[model samples]
Target chain A: MFVWIILIPILIQYTLTSVVPMLISFFLTFTDWNLVGTWNNVGLDNWKRLFSDRAVWDSLKVSVIYALYSVIPTVVIGLLLALAVNTRKKGTAFFKSAWFFPVITSVVVVASIWKWMFTAEADGIINQVLGLFGIEPQFFFGTRLALITVALLGIYQSVGTAMVYYYAGLKGIDTNLHEAAKVDGCTGAQVFFHITLPLLRPTMAYVLITLTSGALKVFDSVYTLYNQTGGPQNAANTLVMHVYRTGFFNMQMGYASTIAYLLFAIIMIISVIQYRITNRDVE
Target chain B: MKKRILNFFFYVICILLCVIFLFPFVVMLFGSLDGETKYAVTLTSWFPTQFSLKQYQSVLSVGGRMSRWVLNSVIISVIPTITGVFLDALLGYIFAKKRFPGRQLIFWYFMAAIMVPYQATIVSNYLLYSWLGWINTYWAFLIPGMWTVLYMFMMRQNIAAIPDALLEAARIDGAGEWRTFLQIVLPVSKPGLSTVAIFSFMNNWNNFMGPLIFTTSEKMYNLVVGLSSLNQQSASFNMQMTAGVITFIPMFLVYMAFQKYFVDGITVGSVKG
Candidate 1:
């Protein structure tokens, strides 16, 4: 039957793409193997090195920082923009479209514009804007500012996603709840806090989970901006970029898989913790 | 009076954010046009003193390879969009309507794959592809994403919503499963197909790391990766901006054409179900 066709393609694709690689990744994490050459079984060596490696720790620190700095604002701004644009007022469509423009556009393009903006030159937008306020040109891609600057660019691309989710959450809320709150003499702020916020918990959890994982997996922003050099002094070097570099560029495939598994572990832990936090109240 | 003021405040804040949201795009377009000199000092003006198509010309230049890059992007994105949509829908239909041995297990496998970072698979996939002699080929892009977990999940949800009665009616009318699926289910799942198409297209079109890692040569570069490489080599700032605009245009057009599906798909498929 044609059911075989459907099942066969999917199974074959998944096996090649995910299953084989994942099993290989697990094996690779134990043995040190460069792509072309034979490898030695360095049992627990990659795992042990992960504990002691300063670069791994530094990249983890950067990943955590990037994850936090990017996710919090994205969720907050998304909620705010959703609340703001989720209205029946004139030109609300325009506002919604404008906010969502970044989401639909390629992240590479956004990063390109931002890279141009963050140029250390006097003509760069950030420098120009700063100059307007009587400040000198700032080398935004430098160590001190590079990570946060990239996160800001990400927030621009991300806020739209948050807004969409929050907007959907807002739409799904019963209008009667709002009217009931109003009738109960609740102020707008009070109503939002008491009802809308609580009701949007599921959406919030989903947004934060996706956003946090996204922040952890960030490659494009830093990749585009720094020309894949991991930004100044490796400040913006993220977990995924670390994995890419170690595996591909440095050809340390085994160690890279170790890092990859560590990242997966981190993601799993964060998801589990957030899952519990967001779900506990329902219990 | 207070309500009026509050509403006005909302307008102010919302509009301000929208402008902020759109500002980079404005710069990517207007700024691209404004100062496209060999050593373009773009800060000189917000608008071009002399309106020139020079930057756009260079991006589309024979030497620049922008046109080739664009062609690569279109071929890569469009093929996958057409092929992947069908693949996802077919597999998704099975997942949705049929119950079989290890069906639950297979679906769970896909779900788990979606959670693992793409970076995790790079080492092994690269080795596998290289072993398959697919490196520096479009098959590197075309084959890997023949079916993605996300698209499959979305398609499953979409196909699941089609009424059982509809399928039974078609079946009772002597329609084969394939005929029923093609005749009835496909028609009903336009929204799902479109959503998958846009996402797959966009993901392919905007993809950077894939082209970066897989294709080792300049000639095989997609729009994003080519522009990114050219970004450093670009003679001037305006050239980069112009290239950005060109890269942005296709996705923008696709989005505008299917704005309803794109937006609704987001709210429906992406948001927590």
Candidate 2:
């Protein structure tokens, strides 16, 4: 009785907030209604429109590219950083904290700082570095480089989180395996590839799935960096950004829900694929 | 000799990566200190040649909006953190320890909620909140986010580790569920509670989208949204850096203070669970 009394309210709140909204979102996909207007049953119209939507496809392409750019580097570099810091040598704590600092920092601040650094002017820090190599000033956010630049910012912020996860994964590995491999005349690289890499599969699955989903839903950095316009020519507009623009800015609720559901489906499919590939040996 | 050489190279590489990671923060800090004259010049140095708090002074001055945003951030973050910790702890305790009808059904229902991406539900959430007259109000952030399934899951895992004997003993002493929760469970689960609190606080403090969408008035903006708006307004780099630094300081301090909890939370969240 007491348990029910306590749990009932939270469950009610949860249903109202999460479950109801989700059901409503599903229902919205079958109907068309701007916030202030009457609902019209559109049935499969939004879904059909999704197929021919050039902007939707463009944003999907941008999101996939962003995810590829961000997720791969985040995983690889994060693992390297984890390996370095996992040496457990003296002074490694400082390095761990230093590397993990950005994970705690807000995305808006990170975008702001990186946007400043990637300023297109010759005097911008990155452009200045380029100039030292006798390269011309590059327009980072102004050109096709915009998506990559935003993706790099995503990588910068998330690499710390990935590093922490990989570090934990590294810590979980049995040191005896490494020593045994070493005694068998296995090289460091060989031990890592043959033993450590395989053992870290579960962690890889977790990291890959989470990072991929996060990357696909990438919005905060791009929104901030591009000033909510999704960059010049919508170059950096991610799927979530497209949803936000459609639903909020354009006031097309039904179409926005359709795009959002499609994104959800994509994430679910990709996460399952990643889980299967990474966990092939585990089961 | 080969091992020593390899170790030396590893250190070199690690040091270089650390510099790469830390450079932007250094830039943000030093950039915030530059006076108007020095900021207008071509970037010749990473460090400010002339150091001044002119930007910070302007950003945080009485006439500025940064302070309001800071307050909004605090209200938005602190309320959710406190409420989330308490409610999640209670609910986690219920799910973990209590024997009740429909427990598995309710728990799985909450678990299933996690599969639905927040983006998918956001459109309806917007419509629902607006219908409830919550737009431009703190209620939008506070209500929907007061308790999360993820935090509840964490708390459930944490609270489950409490030996059943201990809880049984508490009940044997004639303590009610609420008393047992307030007295025994919470004290034993301090580490878990703190971990949840820190994460909750961090997520709320740094949340950009909720505040951005919910709050139309400039005064209602949290620091993250406020800073983004300032950037969108094409504020000077120095000014924007100052805002960035201001926004970052609280989380930095929190991380510094609870550094252990942060690492433990990450490992516990990923590696173990």
Deviation of model 1 at B204, angstroms:
1.3
In the order shown, the candidates' DockQ scores are 0.58, 0.62
Top-lDDT structure, candidate number: 2
lDDT of 2 at A16: 86
lDDT of 2 by residue, B1-273 (tens): 988998898789888888888988998898899865333323476677789988887788885789889899999999999999998898898889888789999999988766677776688988888888998888998888888788898999999999999989989999987899999999999999998899999999999888888788999899999999988888887888889999999999999999988877775545452
lDDT of 1 at B44: 55
How does the DockQ of candidate 2 come out?
Answer: 0.62
User: Candidate 2's error at A167, in angstroms?
Assistant: 1.1
- Listed in order, each prediction's TM-score against the native is 0.94, 0.95
Q: Report the C-alpha lDDT of model 2 over A44-151, residue by residue, as the tens digit.
A: 999999999999999999999999999999999999888888888877889999999999999999888888778888898888878999999999988669998988
lDDT of candidate 2? 0.86
